[model samples]
Target chain A: MRGLFAARPLLLWPAGCALLVASVAVAITIGPAGISVGEVAAVTVSRLGGADSGLSAIREGIVWDLRLPRTLLAAVCGAGLALCGVVMQSLLRNPLADPFVLGVSSGASTGAVLVVVLGVGGGALSLSTGAFLGAACSFALVLGLGHLSGGTTDRVVLSGVATMQLFSALTSLVVMSSADPEQTRGVLFWLLGSLSGASWPDVWPCLLVLLLALPACLGRAPALDALVFGQDAAGSLGIHVARTRLALLGVTALMTAALVSVVGAIGFVGLVLPHAARAIVGPGHRRLLPVSALAGAIFLVWADTVARTVLDPQELPVGVVTSLIGVPAFVHILYRGRRTA
Target chain B: MSLRAEDVSWSVGGRMIVAGVSLEPAPGQTVGLLGPNGSGKSTLLRLLAGVRRTSSGVVRLDGAPLEEIGRKGAARRIAVVEQEATPQVDLTVGDVVRLGRIPHRRAWAPLSSADEAAVEAALGHTGLTDQAEQSWHTLSGGERQRAHIARALAQEPRELLLDEPTNHLDVRHQLELLDLITRLPVTTVIALHDLNLASMFCDHLVVLREGRVVAAGPPERVVTPRLVSEVYGVRAVVSPDGPGGRPYVRFLPPTGEAR
Candidate 1:
């Protein structure tokens, strides 16, 4: 399959797009409400721009309001996170680099906590607004600290670790000192990442951000390919290394911030999906970026479906489900890498 | 003169790595830089390649300052091949060679026929046409060096700079690689450790010590017993029987303990 796609790489894009659409449709049907793919399709078509189907209000509500938005949000979040992962890993030249691992998500969590627990915005700011600000601040701090410490790629990753720990501590301090038991539970579920409250309002903005970012990233594919051999090599190949790094890093941070603000920090989708996509389509970012996004969208749609329906009446954080799958896949990647090394 | 460096110097912190060095290699001439570990050969090559900025003085191509030429413009005219290029990501040999076309590509434009032709010619020149689809990790050290040269060749550069490209290869591979480098049409500046190989291949030679140029001339005048003893702290017998009357150096065994 890898060889076939590697030969005719353009075919993979259409296949990936179809798979994503199919995954979203299938995921919308597998909840507590006994909806089928037909019902999901009918509701989406009618609500989007077709004639109204003669279905009951409650059933249509379940298909349209309850499941469809949540499923679409999962797809967008997955695609966005995976795209960020591919860029970060290639830029940093480390297989382990991801937004969640770099503490961008933790930074977002801290910002959301401050707004919710202390009313930092004095009841005027929404949770996503607080989270975006927090995400930007933490990323800036990471970049500043990394710059101060020689600004090497390894140093940037180390700075990310330091920033992550600091923000996570601040988030814990705010939650423990101020929140009551009920609010604490809500915050905990969010930190672990949940799409349970996903709605249409959350889906479009994240989708729009992804739409804008994918093209911007694709335009820089040759630059990313130059970076595979490290910054010096990239510079020798005519890339303005610092400028390219700053531009790509800024894009990934912005997209990751927007997605985390909407759905909390979903782990492993960013970390693990890029590697899988690379294996299938090879590492040329022209091909890898879109394939990774599609694979991530499909993977998360299914992962969220299992998270919400596995125990019936009790939902697991989607992060937990992804981690359950991600850890083993991560180990397999390592094991395979060892053989190659 | 093709690629020229006029009194270029580089320093890190308070320490100078390359100081007050000037060089001008004529077009199509192969120049060898001979020096010990801390002799600044690599730094000088980097400065010439425009990968590193000189702390003082200037480096120029065709009498124009490299800074004014911009990175992409310079890359189109000059190519640098370091000792090794080890990427953590998986890349095929063809992918690695194709990286040479980066300077000529626009962001949204597809790869053109010119790009494909350059890549194929480079692979053919280096005898790597069959290995284009092979994984980079599967290549031997000599093959890797050839691939690096192939990558440089694909750049279609007028000047090529290399830093100790034969460091890890065996004797035969080392000779073959140097032979290949000298045969190229581009003006070449290569850093070398082995004096005999330097004497054999270089049209001119420059010897550096402690960030300063100690000797600069043809190999017959540059590679001498007294200079080798002074610079490398070794006793050597110099004979003029090597290829093309270039001085051949054979190190004599130590006569006493601790000099």
Candidate 2:
């Protein structure tokens, strides 16, 4: 776990960012019609200068319209999910607590689908707003269930799983009963997580959330360090246990709701990236949160690139690649926990 | 600064865990709280630390009510080490100790040189400097105890409260921990089960029985054979004193046959 530049963690922020930039530059070039990494970079730089890089307008359009926005969205989603993973793990004092695994995202999916199908607010509320409400509902349900069942880590996780199943069933019923074939297709694509139609419109809100949530999380890092020890220790250290828990819960839920609404229920980035970043930067959130965010951005940029390029003309859902990676990662964590215990 | 509890009480589920108990330790005194199992030692310590709100009565820090100062303000002056301080995370010894600086640091401010020096001094005081980078989960019970003390020490607090800190420690570590607490120029309130350790190190002793103060005074006077036998259900004779010049309790054979 201490292998990834744990000693010089300050170096990780800039290095990780540079790695993301390079990965984006390289990943944008890979697609059905072969374009080189160098050509991708040139086209991107030329567009920045407001000059057409002597390539065909079709290639330029592909670079600007299709690939760039999708890649950036992937980065944002990855960072947001991972950052929230750091928060949920610390807040719940359980590493197994991720939005997707705990079924918190299923709540958001239900909200978005409610809007997509039944039109819950009669055009007054957006899908994103509904999704946020659903996330909060799921969070409340999980906490209530956990309290009812003694609220151990195992119980909390089980409650999350239960909440997830219930919401998913309700979401499917809403979709199946109401949506037309075309809207159903889009909803299905969303459920599975496809970044097919990414644009600048999708970029700003995510950027705004990241800008707001990342610093907010950073401010709570020290309090989080005490929390992983236990509530008593945190309280002794002068943390108002109930208030701190409430604040962190609100922050993590908000960020996760926003990200899930934008990009369906993208799993694994939340679970995988935080652990990876912990190994690289050690367990303090001051370093871990930023490193996790960067690692997530780097991870998804490549995952999304692979999702698009793995099958030349046909595209795969980004969630498919992440799940393929996440299942093994989760098993490894359980194994590690057993060995340590 | 002094810590004074004025008729403090706490209850849970309508059961009185800590009944009316008032205690006042002098400035920079090492006061040991001794009690039998289920005698409210831990509860009293929590009340003193302001982590547990008292059902009735006030715990004052240097004359100001502890709760009135607020958690952040109280934490700035008081550091409490609970009995179970083992962390359930992949953290190093350094990471745990650094948390003591939380009440002191601004949320946005990074760890300063002063914070580093405090942590360094604490690790050294607890003889944990070499293990600062060691994984927390890998520590032995005694080492973990020391790490907890080191963490509390890192807070640079004026009032220190420890709940049964020596339970997991070996004899040497137990002595070392109490020795460090007595020598540190702070108002220390420690809850201990070992009467001998309490007698040898603490400036004063407060003994609790069923959530009430049964005895309170210097160790030599308060630690009587009758007191030990009555409070702990043990038949013991009070020897003259240990090498530390404090009364030692030597148990005689039980008056009743072993059932």
Query: Which has the greatest TM-score?
Result: 1
What does the lDDT read for residue A203 in candidate 2?
A: 79
Worst 10 residues of 2 chain A by lDDT: A332-341
Q: Which is the leading candidate under lDDT?
A: 1
For candidate 1, the lDDT comes to 0.90
Residue A336, model 2: lDDT of: 66
Pairs that collide, model 2: A1-A279
The candidate scoring highest on DockQ is 1
- In the range A1-341, model 2's lDDT, one tens digit per residue, is 57547776667768888898998888887777677887787788898895657889898888888888889999998898899888888877777677565566899889888987888899987877887788878988987898799756567678888999999999889888899998888777777776777887887888888899888888888788878778877888888877776677667777777777777887788877787677667888888888889888888888888888888678888899888876787677667656455
| TM-scores for all predictions | 0.96, 0.90
How does residue B34 of candidate 1 score in lDDT? 94
For model 1, the stretches where C-alpha displacement exceeds 4 angstroms are A332-338, B253-259
